[model samples]
Target: MLSNTDIAELLARQAERESGILSRAFRRAARSAFLWPEEVANVIAQNRSLTELRAIGPFIERQIRHWIDKPPHSTHRAPTIRRDFVSLAKARQLLARKPAWAKILRGDLQMHTRWSDGSGTIAEMADAATDRSYEYIAITDHSKGLKIAGGIDEQALKKQGNEIGKLNAFLRKSGRNLLVLRSVEMNLNRRGEGDMSPESLLALDLVLGSFHSSLRIVEDQTNRYLAALRNPHIQILGHPRGRIYNFRIGLSADWPRVFAEATSLNKAMEVDCYPDRQDLNIDLLKIAREHGTHISLGTDAHHPWQLEFIELGLAAALKAKLPADRIVNFMPIGELKSWVREVRGRAPRRP
Candidate 1:
């Protein structure tokens, strides 16, 4: 039986053999294979159309059927960009083995709302979190530096805080345990400098710093990661690799040194659970485990339902065998907040 990874590699190889729109569609289908909730073979065995899978249409379905019927010898080696990503089916299987792992998760650390580029409003996201029984969810929308994502300015961030405050009060009065954290995905430059002001960041419950530009540089980025970790404004370094499936391979750096720095600083690096962008994948997470660095999980969700994406990160962490004490999302809301406060306390005093 061909696994999802095999199917993805097969499709990718087939894509290379073709050109134009057909090739793009094959490449997209290959990426979508990682996100497909079920194995294509299972669907086929159940007499279901392969089109039921994402990125699959009648044309792609026919091609997939051919591959399934006559297993193709894969010519493509899994590149760094496409390696070690877990399929939804695989994540479910892993979680099934340790049924309590998913239950221990208290909240999602990174997500967005309409205050930025997200499709859902704050109330909608809160309601969704409530549905998931999440103790809290951070609203880490894009900050002003990333205009392309409709990043929010400091004034808008303050306004967003007011909304979060009101929602928290309402939830409290209603006896719901869910809390919405005021946070922003602050854009960081290559120099490890943030785009937003310190005063503005200080007002939020937590801040996530990520690199939004210059991601394609081939040189080692050890100094950049070191500087970002030392930069006091961020408690979590979001998506440290900046990689995207089949699109960008992400940056290179001496990861052990970077992980060690994060460990010494008591900071966390993220496992962004966007299917196509599962940064801090299992390979790197293993290195982090050796360094005893803290791992944070975020769906990088733009809408509420996307919160389910957390499973990918959870599975990645489980596969990495990271210590429960070191995974921040495993903490309850109060403890999670305290961890943030502790990290913030260690941040250098701003001039």
Candidate 2:
């Protein structure tokens, strides 16, 4: 139960951490603006902050990080719209050719091969993503909770780590830039906690928290996520909500508070690439953006082809008007490593 004053205090402390451009513009815009989108837009367009604007304009709330008017689907012709000042068609064309294995950054990258769900072995997944240019791939296997899906418990996890070591050795023999990260996809259980215990979670390179069940309880949903964040071992909260099509979670809890807590603790939230279960809806995403929360866009990828969700996520992020740097996917390898280390305090990672 966070008080309004608490929220204000937290926000104020964070304001100091904001960049100079943001601080000035927001201050200027906060004053004298009426509640009008056009006026708000005018202030931003003219480089004025709400505090220094002509009027305290209408507080424009974004349901997403930004808005996206996607190109209409075209069968015979290419689709087009404007995204970040670039013609949508041009961006799409540029991306359409990127190898499916391609990733935005390199290093600390690991992927799965045929040994698990996708089409390769530890070494093979690394080679493919490397071919497309990625630095690291976290080879997170399903945990014991997902029995039907080859979930691994302590024994399985240790084995995976050992195997990753071998892969690293093989890669080093040839002087390749790659690292196999040992990780897991944890499930958000009935108790609001994720699948594995905090102690177990701490051992992995990264743990993706997801709501595999108990998603209907909308009232306590945000609290559930907050509790998960309190656990230092959980590095990334995956698909905060468990909303699958035809069965949406119907937006629950105080997202502002949730994002605030996560950002304060330096935890990462997921922007799952699974369209079928677009759990953390646009509105929540907007909250993350406004709160300056760090977001991780995952494909919730069950197969190799699913990794392509990165491009699709770009469309969503563009629509939200979110800055690319705000996303973990767009982060450089070192920054990504640093943030993960900060959250888990587990580093000098094993070779």
| Best model per TM-score | 1
On residues 1-351, what C-alpha lDDT tens digit does candidate 2 reach at each position? Answer: 221112222223333456686544333322111112233334445766534423222331220001112221321211111001222222244445653322443432223344445555666667755664656677766677866666667776777778888888988798887666777776657554656665566667777765566666646566677887776567777767666432344436778999999888777777665544444556667888898887776655555644544444454555565666667756766777777777776423434
Candidate 2 segments whose C-alpha is farther than 4 A from its true place = 1-120, 197-200, 218-220, 247-251, 345-351
Q: Against the true structure, what is each candidate's TM-score? A: 0.97, 0.64
Question: How many clashes does each candidate structure show, in the order listed?
Answer: 0, 41
Least lDDT summed over 10 consecutive residues: which range in candidate 2?
Answer: 77-86
Candidate 1 structure lDDT: 0.91
RMSD of each: 1.3, 16.9
lDDT of 2 at 99: 39
Clashing pairs for model 1 are none
Ten-residue region with minimum lDDT total, candidate 1: 72-81
